[model samples]
Target: MIDARRGVLYPDRMPRFHRLPPMPEAQHLVAWFWIPEWDLGPGETSRQDVVAYPALNLVVEPSGVQLVGATTAATHRDLTGRGWAVGALLRPAAVPALAEKPSELRDSWAGLSAPDLLEPVAAAMDGDDDDRLLRAVAIMSRWLAERAGEPTDAGLQANAMSELLMTDAGIRTSEQAATRLAVSLRTLQRMTHRYVGLPPLAMIRRRRLQEAAQRLRDDPGIDLAALAAELGYADHAHLTGDFRTVLGMAPSGYRQEL
Candidate 1:
C-alpha cells in the first residue's frame, strides 16, 4: 500500500480517508486511488494540510470532475458540510493523454469535460452499501484505462524516471537519477517537465522533505541534525530551509503543533 498518510501533514485531523490499490486494468496509469468522506454539522469545517506527492490527480466530486496538477509545495483544503471525493493519483505514463502541458498546470487544477468518466462513478458513490467505495473505484479505474489507452515507449521511460526520483533514497541528485535510468540529463529534464510538471531534483527534494516531516512526526525524540544527514541534506540548516520554505514552519514548530 502507498502510505496514504505520508503526504498528509496531520492525520488526526483528517476525515474518513481510504487509500486503495488501483485495479489491474489501470495499474500502469494510476499509482493508487483515494477517497475521503466527511460529514460535519452546521458551521463545522475540517482543514486538511498536505505536502502533496509530485504527481497529478484526477478527482471526482459530487458537483463535477477536475484534473488536479502536481504541487510544488505544501497545500491545504477546507471541507465543509457533507462531502466526499474520489481521486486517482496518476502515473507518468498516463499524463500525456490527459494533459497537454503539465508544467503550465502546476499548483492548480482545471475542470474536465469527462462526464463519461464521472457519471457512473458518481452513481456508484451515491449508493448506500458496504461496497460503494469499491464499486466507485472500479468504475473510475475502468474509465481511465479506456480513456488513456496504453502508454508508449517514451511514456514508460517517463514512468521509470519518476520511480527512480521518488524512491531510491540513494538518489539525491538529477544526475544520479539519469545515470540510474540510463538516460541523458537533458532527457530526464524534458521527461519530468512534460510528464510530471516538476524537475527531477524537485521530485527528489519533495521525497526527502516528506520523509523528514514523517520522521519528525513519528519520532519526537529524534535529533534534527542527524535526521538531516540521514536524508542526504548537506546539514541541519539545509533541512530547516526546506521545512521553512515548503511547509512554512520550522521543524520544532511543526513538532510543537502536534
Candidate 2:
C-alpha cells in the first residue's frame, strides 16, 4: 500500500491480481489522472500498489493524482521541477487523436501536448471551490473519447503489457505475447510497436535492466548471479552486458555512483 499527505499529487496505485490488456492494431487516444497533496507520511514505511501509466505522464505537484492501493497509501511530494507539469505519452498506433482522424484510426492515434491540457488541470487544482479537477479530467476524457472512441486506448494496453513483462521477468518473444493475446505474431508485433515503441523483447530487457539498476543502488551486496537469475537473464555476464548497454555503465560502477 502507499500513503499520501493532505495535499500532494502522486501516481495511481498499481493493480494487483490484475493485468493490462493487449494493444489494438489501430490508432487510439489515452488520458491520465494526476493528483497532488499537501503533506505525506514518513518515508521507508509507507507503500502503495502503483499501476504504472503506460504512456508519458504529466506529473503536477502542489496537486497531483491521488494514488489508491489495497493496503498502503501516501501523498507524493514534488522532487523535481515546479508544481506545473506537461508531458506526453507517445506511442505508435496509440498516438494522440488530434493528430489523426477517423480514417487514420486504423494507423495511428492522436498526440497531445501536456501543456495544452495542463492549463485547465492547473486551474481546477488551484481553486478551493471548483470541480476543477473533475472538469479537467472530463475535458481530457471528452477530447480523448472523441478522438479514440474509448477512454483507455492502446497506450493503456501497452502499459498493462509492460507491467506483466516486468512482473514475469520476461516473455522471450512476440510469439508469447501473441499467445496471450490470441493473435498472430505479426499482429502482436505491429500492435506492440505502435503502442509501446519498442518490440516486446527490448521492453522486457529494459525493464529487467532497470530493476537490476535499482537493486544495485538500494543494496550493493545483492548477489549479482542471483539477481540475474531473478530477472531471467541467462547468467550474471548476460545481465551485466545488458546493464552496460542500457545504463552505459556496469552494475558495479552504477553502485559506486550511488
Best by TM-score: 1
Cα lDDT of all candidates, in order?
0.90, 0.45
Task: Specify the poorest-scoring 10-residue window by lDDT in model 2.
Answer: 1-10
Candidate 2 TM-score, true structure as reference? 0.55
Candidate 2: tens digits of C-alpha lDDT, residues 1-258: 011111111113211111111123221333234443333345422233222222333233334422111111112323322233322232333343333222232222333345555566577657766455555455555444454555365556654564555455436565776677666878766655555444566655655665676667457799889988887788989987875665556777756655
Clashes of each: 0, 45
Query: TM-score for every candidate vs. truth?
Result: 0.98, 0.55
Most accurate candidate by lDDT: 1
